[model samples]
Target: MYPEPVWTEWEDPDDFAEAFQLHVERHGENVYRLHKAITAQGFKIDPQTLYTWKRGDKEPRSATGLRVLKAIERRYRLPDGYFSSKLAHSGRMITGGGLEKLSVVERRRLAWHLPDNFDLLPRAKRAEILAWVRTVIISGATDYRRYHANAVLHRFSFRFSEGASPLPFPKPRPLEERLADEGAPEVGRPVQTERAPIILDTEARDLRLFKTATLTTGGRGRNGVWNDETANQKMEHLGLLFGALAACPEGEVRGYGAPVRCMTFAVLLFPAVWDWYLRWREIKRGFFTRWESEMLTVVAGLTRQGTGWLRQSPHLAGYLRPIAGLITPADIVAATEDWDGVCETIHRHAIVRAKEVDRVARVHRDPFEPILTILEADSPLGEYRKISEEVRRRRPDRRRFPVAAAEATRGYLMIRMGLHLGLRQKNLRQLLVVPRGRSPTPERQLEALKRGELRWSDRDGGWEVFVPAVAFKNAGSTFFRKSPLRLILPDLSGLYDEIDVWLRLDRKALLKTQPDPRTFFVKTVKNKSNSGAYEQHKFYEAWRSIIQRYGIYNPYTGRGAIEGLLPHGPHNVRDVLATHVLKQTGSYEQASYAIQDTPDTIAEHYGRFLPQDKAALVAQVLNQVWGS
Candidate 1:
């Protein structure tokens, strides 16, 4: 016996364990008594399970686990969510909730989003519910999204491992020898055409030096070094270039079948090599795309005289191995002996080739294709807000699905911030948060880190976002004039309340016990991944996921915010903002201010102010005479 209960006033428990223990003690009962009472009430829960729950060793995860907590609440004469609300959002898959019909992977993903009474529902009803969740939430059923899902599976680009320096990869067996050993492919099956390029020791070093170094060892004739992101893009681009060069012509890639051993960086110095590669790309793609133009631009920079990487690094010539038609043995000798003259010749050829590629470079994929519904609207920003509304409408139950609820809240704020700030993806994901009543991070520190901060502003009486000029990709643009970006976030549409709730509860739920990355938006912490920070690809996926789940309409299930909406990323928000202003004001200057860009940039890239939109604006003003 627990010695007749004394009147002890306990502080509110911060968690399920504390709450459970406090209630049991206040009632002057032990776990055995509590278990017996629950059993008497027709609920069979393990005595040890009660002990574990009391001890904070485990709380509840599955529906059964939750039911046991409900029974305990009833025994204690507490509210339905008394103990349940205090449980941590473990983010682990919640099973044993009538998901037996689902595949193991499906069960893992759908468990958190399922209703509490999901198991009790009829078999046909469960199937209907699952179909909706799978289509709208998991698959993001949209035309473009479906296409993207399939497209990513057929990866043709090379992936350089992180921290991969210019060093020799393991020597690959000759293609013919390896193929013979594996035997011939079946008639119907697709043949493996492109093997990862086997880079030599010299070529790898040159590749490294070209991308990472600020200046060549000699420190002459170069434009600039590539940033990490740019460097990665270049590596991927170059990988595709090399992969196409090495792929078998007979196979699907329809590539040149150049010897893997001879595919050195030196091949880039030859005019004929560039010509062959350029022509092969055009043939493969069936039209000129920006890819060809971008690749040519990279080549021109690499081979440009006085500062070109290939020109400055003469030793690359020594590594050149002849590819029968592309590079003759004599050409290699000539290039090695007269590196400067050969570079000068190739540099001129590259410049001429780049101009030719640009003339025919068709826009392969329209940037606006995904969000045409939003962008084509008279009020694009107004139309875009439907996504946030949809997110709020479809938000899950917080007590039962804390992590999912937090994720929904985060998605809402992500769209809100993107609309208000129009900051690039890097600037947005890296933006830090300092809650109300806390001292803001110093501007100098933000500039040093090249990130922005969202903080409470007592003077402005609203939330303020401050990012240094140096944080922007276009820091030197005349729009900034070296001034930092400062904007007071409008406290509208429950924006302030949402931010406060996120900081107080939702954000922490997503982080769990993981170390806070200090960023406003965080990835849901799981066992496999502990960090709460958003990487580039993960961040892009997060934005796209939000759009997929809420933005695109599905006629079959009758969910989503907009009809004909496709999956797009954070960058598309800038287009939305710019176009919105352009439609209203008909001034590129005002439109530029919306996204912090120059009028020329808005005219050329951002704003989609069609001739009709411009004419309509003029007609609206001119028609004022008829109204009078």
Candidate 2:
């Protein structure tokens, strides 16, 4: 029997009347009521007007207008694209309007009107605004219009404007011209001024503001002051003031704010200011010199002695009195000729703490070795070897072995796989063996191994475990890619197959303890008491224990365990693979392609052909070529 078609009609006709009628019938009475409601809400325009919107006759008014249209769609229970034409028109209008001209101040006002939270705009948009503001400032666009634009940018945060409203000029000027003008004084003669040590009452307000601003901006912290861009700006202003004062006659330096003097200030102030300016120049090219004026004011205040300063100054003399004891012949040579005796005296007195400075420099100079050692020795591979050796020596029975041996092996596997794959602990825990469709569980461990598909093809050859995006730290939609260390090993395919067999055998019993079919690593009785089932912390502890057991010392660290391995983590395996490939091929380009590493990184970390192993590697290669 033929079924009768449902017939429905829209009361208020529009360009999409036929489609709307069809949609109303398909969606039922609830949708029809929604359509009527939307039409009643002043959206019941003529069909031709709707058609104009659909056919690009007009544009959408604003983002709000688009939202209104979307609301209508929701009310009528329409498909996503049902009112897409109207929404898109609205979008075009808004996009065009966004480019409309506005003065710098107006722009700032607009930006202020935007949501207060940081995340309101996309990162790219924020970056664009930041870049634009920099460009405008660099271009010396100091007019009211430009400043208004700057104000708009400043509305995003004080960090953007550095707490000052954008400079307002009546018109744009060249950077050079602006600098020249700024350098010139407004009056030919100096204003009435007096030079005196800083009085607590007079300088108090400005000093307070300075301290508050510095603290609020994250300048002062436990680690010492952070020399950020704003600090650099201040330093430049100081430099300018210093230069100006130096040029001025000694007596003419009259109107200085305060006279404060401390030896530490005398030693550090100029250098610190210079360094800040240098760093600022490195980060941003051609920031003009307002720093000199500001720095002069600070210096003036430092010349005054507070009660706190008076108390602290005497302590400094005794503290470094033994610096002379530490001075060496090399230190004498390094010291300037004029200051050599002074330097030696400082070193002998123990006043300078030179060794501490040297130690800090050394650590900074070579950070890679220590950091890698710490991470790797505490890794899974190191742990595994430890446990395996323990079990082999003990030779415990099968029941006890499962409890001790299997637990150890599992920890090792997790660490090994995690480092090799660079999977975060949570994602590593969530890893599952993708099953073949229409297949039931098999009793055979080897069959289960064959069924589990969790591997990826390597660049060189063979397969390694493939870590999907869900398992990655970033939680991206795309899979996190990595190549296996086996690719660089001799008989790569054979080694991979051996690892596969090893995993299958080890996981066989553990598989039976799974709480759900989707869970990959099943908890055996040994690991049942472990928190989170597969916690990374447990893996770390197990690794540390294994390192102590195996006594594997890194040659670099003179310490036992995998911590000696350079560039730790799953990535280190890749580094090792890349290093070996470079050695084997003796071709930088080929090695780079094989391991997918940059030439620079490879050269820096992996390219060094160890002196001890060089002869043996070459001999082996030569023998292979000669059929020895």
Candidate 3:
């Protein structure tokens, strides 16, 4: 029997078996010698009982076998209750979820190279290959043989820490589901994750694809420059999308987050299913011809016409269908036909789950109150009151080419634009200070804004910034909007003065070398000829910098350098907008239009009143009840 605290907390016999397997290592397939070695450790269990325990068929209910199991755990060098964590006290990892989270490349390396009990192996020696996956886009690795999968994994650094994905990974659970012997069940509280998966400096890795695109097409390939540019960006977004899918947790549609198996399986098997369909139809072969044939037949038989797919397997076709190709949208309602009404249920749950985990940790319950107070100080053109004037000042440095002051002013302007406009991150980032038709130097752009009139060729004389349809995320979806979005900036009196000073002094310093840039927000590059116009990531970085300055941007999980920084990211700024608008106007539709979100979405996420607001209303009603 096992000693105390080793496998004592285990709820499932199978769990104990897996943990035991961790100790059964390098027996070199010698069962008799392995059993003898385990028995020598002071617990005497015959091979027969050990086999049953390994198979999880026979549970040691009585105290009779505890010492033997503990012997196996200690012999294997596993920590106490290595696989079973009922009270959530142990630190040893017993589940495959962490391994599963590694990209497709890492999973293959672990599965193919590592032993069954590799967790027991010297920790450093495992992972014979360095990287899991080298490529960003989903490769043809799902094909039958997974040709060159190892080669791909070997080329890149596939670090499998929680930081690999941008979205939050699901909380860890025991390998086998367990029910306590007594009292109410414990659904465990949310634990702070070790590292945030989302990385802000994603552009460095992501932008490489665009460089390749430019080299391949010279300008735009056959599709034209703009069209090709859009397509390339879509390819870049897939890495993050896969990470989001990876982040989904597992469990019931009602109480728990999306299941990990349910999530990864949904994507992993998606392309595999298509390959499966092709092999069945004799269009393409997988792994090898014969293995592919047998695997296909087994899968087809499982979904055989009369056997009832839902009855035999619990896998939801709806979830799989959406992700299967990753080429187009999945049919949600169709996926649920056999899902026992769980497809819609889980989909909805995933949405809500995604939102909660994605929220910034430091965001105040009333995010707007802090922002409003900051905005009210009448310092849009000046430095924040909290910081000393010596550190950062509103006054523009009149020095020739004042780089520091210029960049600071630009950052200040960008943050104010985000708050005042209540614009979505994407929209806010794409804003044009100078119309595309005009040469957009800092001076020219500032002149345009201060001119007090719309100066673009496409519109009237007032200050209206028009965003093209192609720029919208929902441009293809008819339900969301009619594009060619128009934004009217509210007339904050000192706005022109801020822009004018930035143009004449601060921004003017940066723009001294490069002239005739097209975008208002220009990055300072050493190159005199290039203004580094349209440097997209700066807008995001600027928003985050100002938020950090306020000391309000808190990440739920920790991250490294600026590249690893998630810091609620720019999207949460929209949440701030929604809450503020809803609080002031009490109109979901108005708030939605202001933020360019659907009313339903606004209501769903931000409609709930703040506790303070609710208490005030309740107090008011009570006062009325007392006949004021």
Which model is ahead, 1 or 3, in terms of TM-score?
1
| Highest-scoring model, TM-score | 1
Better of 1 and 2 by TM-score: 1
Tens digits of per-residue lDDT, candidate 3, 1-628, equal 3322333233332244454553453333345666777667665677888777556555442223544545555655556544332111111222242465666654552232222343444545444321211111122122221433432332211112211122322342331221111112123322221221223123222222223333432132222122333433532333323323333122111122212233322232233333433333232122123323333332232233334222232332322323323312323333434443433333333344334433422221333332333323223113222321211333223342267566656665665665555555655554555643664234334333321222333444334565554555544444245445555555464655556676555655666666645455666556644555544566556554444333231121111112111223356546656655555555678767656667887777644445675465467667996895
Give model 1's TM-score versus the native structure. 0.74
TM-score of each: 0.74, 0.28, 0.37
Q: Write candidate 2's Cα lDDT for 1-628 as tens digits.
A: 1112354454433333344444445555434354355567665534444444444444334444454446656655555545543122111222222334656554442332122221235677655654543333222223433434443332110011223222221232332332232222212223222231122112222222333343432232222222333344443343333322222222232212111211112222223333443343323223323232233334433322331121112222211111111222332223323232332332232222223223332211222332333323323234424433432333222232344444445544544454344343344554555332323233244222322224334454444344322223233221224322222223322344434543555565554454444434545534444422444444344443433322333222122333333212233334434445555655556545533445665666544445444565567777897884
Model 2 is weakest, by summed lDDT over 10 consecutive residues, at 316-325
Q: What is the lDDT of residue 295 in candidate 2?
A: 37
Point out the higher-scoring one by lDDT: 1 or 3. Answer: 1
**CA lDDT of every candidate:** 0.76, 0.35, 0.40
Candidate No. with top lDDT: 1
Model 1: which ten-residue window has the lowest total lDDT?
A: 182-191
Over 297-365, each residue of candidate 1 has an lDDT whose tens digit, in order, gives: 787787776667777777665456667677776687688689888887877787787788888788666
